[model samples]
Target: MSTVSVREFSYNPSAVLARVEKGEAIQVTRHGNVIAILSPAGSPMERYAHLVAQGKIKLKPVTAAERHSMPHYEVPEDVDPVALLLAEREEDDR
Candidate 1:
């Protein structure tokens, strides 16, 4: 765990965030009183693992073939997506 004053947190937020990203907890203090604790956000699977363990949810592991079965689309070379979007917005304003 690491302790950082509120001023230090505000001055160099990225450094503090880097510490948190490494699985280290950070304590933010203001006026010598603890204010908040910063921790890394767990992966989606980790977040739901507890639910699965408690029998509240069932999860099926996806096979490699199943993963690649979803439909895929390719944009054409002549298409100008930004221009199309701007034209659509202009139409909506009329």
Candidate 2:
């Protein structure tokens, strides 16, 4: 969720559209109080389509962490820094 003052929106209309394109809901305010909610309309599928077209939606896989305790492990001392960074990036993509 996000918010913007009416004055700001009036000055920069694109900013509000950009936020909405990124799948963010926005509250437009006036006089320091909320006046309106700008959000997608129609069914869930339609809203999803609109968001995607605006390049606002992202899909990623979620994995649950092990609930029980596990033994701590250490990384190999000789591991390459570049390899470590690539591994981290791969994990993020997952």
Candidate 3:
């Protein structure tokens, strides 16, 4: 770990970034109080794969209750539910 003032970081951003890219931890401070940290970005796909591998993620099971719980979009009172569903299905089929 290395401690550098914000001014040093700002003036030599490339040098500081090089340290960060090498996994060296940094502390950004203002008035001698630490404010922030710089670390590596997380890979979303890798996280999802790990969760799936560990069986921590589950697909939601579809049920009649699930279907009934869904909110209906407001349309003209004359609109029919069956017709709307058929139109949606037709669009999906295309």
Candidate 4:
């Protein structure tokens, strides 16, 4: 999601609308509080096709060998990812 202040939204609505039209979700905020969410009007596939027509998104077909070569990871059951992320964010504040 993307966020824009109420003042910014009022000043340049077209830019924000463009993002929404491209299937991005935008959060409108006022005084640091979220007031509304702007989303694309049509289905996700329809929006994606629109973006493709506008040259905003590109479609490419991956070869079978290419897919086989992709790397994957195995998560350890003992790891709590959310806790690790929160701890990392807290450390960054210092």
Candidate 5:
């Protein structure tokens, strides 16, 4: 890691950028105060690497065939919430 003043960076941006291209992190400064850091970009998969490693994220979505093969819970027959609510509302009007 290295620091570069804004003026110094402005004067020789290519040199600073070249260091970053080689995977070194550089902190940019203005008035001796740090403003930004420039570093090499990571691969797309790197974004989710941490979550996948923690087992909190799945790399691939569930396959349609697997979804169809899974047994599903069946709701009780004739148990319509909307119908029950409507019946209750009708009773309230009486």
Candidate 6:
């Protein structure tokens, strides 16, 4: 399962939902504490049912260790997007 901060989750809910629809489970956290868990439409085990049926997984976990953290970017609250866009457009006209 993967974890996402509330801010991150809310920032792009469609992207997160797309991942969940593809059988990826996600944990939503607030202030470092978990607040919700999002799973696929069916049972939690449904994601693996096909692999088990094909006799590939054997109902055992064999995941490799992962310790990478995703980068988080924050924009200053007072930043003006319209001004930035206008500035970029002006620069492009040069």
Report how far off residue 70 is in candidate 1 (Å).
Answer: 45
Local accuracy by lDDT, each model: 0.70, 0.63, 0.62, 0.71, 0.70, 0.70
User: lDDT score, residue 72, model 3?
Assistant: 75
lDDT for 6 in candidate 2 is 91
Q: Score candidate 4 by lDDT.
A: 0.71
Model 4 stretches astray by more than 4 angstroms: 43-94
Candidate 1 has its poorest 10 consecutive residues by lDDT at 44-53
Candidate whose lDDT is highest:
4
The digit string of per-residue lDDT tens for model 2 on 1-94 reads 4668899889998978787776666667787666665765542344444454354663232345642454344558798755877887899999
Off by over 4 Å in 2: 42-94
Best candidate according to TM-score: 6
Worst 10 residues of 5 by lDDT: 43-52
- Comparing candidate 1 with candidate 6, which one achieves the higher lDDT? 1
TM-score list, all predictions: 0.43, 0.42, 0.41, 0.44, 0.44, 0.47
User: What lDDT score is found at residue 53 in candidate 5?
Assistant: 40
Cα RMSD of all models vs. native, in order, equals 14.5, 14.3, 17.2, 13.5, 17.6, 18.0
Candidate 5 at residue 25, lDDT?
Answer: 64
Q: Candidate 6: minimum summed lDDT over ten consecutive residues — where?
A: 64-73
Compared with the true structure, what per-residue lDDT tens digits does model 6 show for residues 1-94? 6889999998999999999989887767788766666778775466665554344654333344431343233447698755766877899999
What's the lDDT for residue 57 in model 3?
66
Q: List the residue pairs that clash in candidate 6.
A: none
Better of 2 and 6 by TM-score: 6
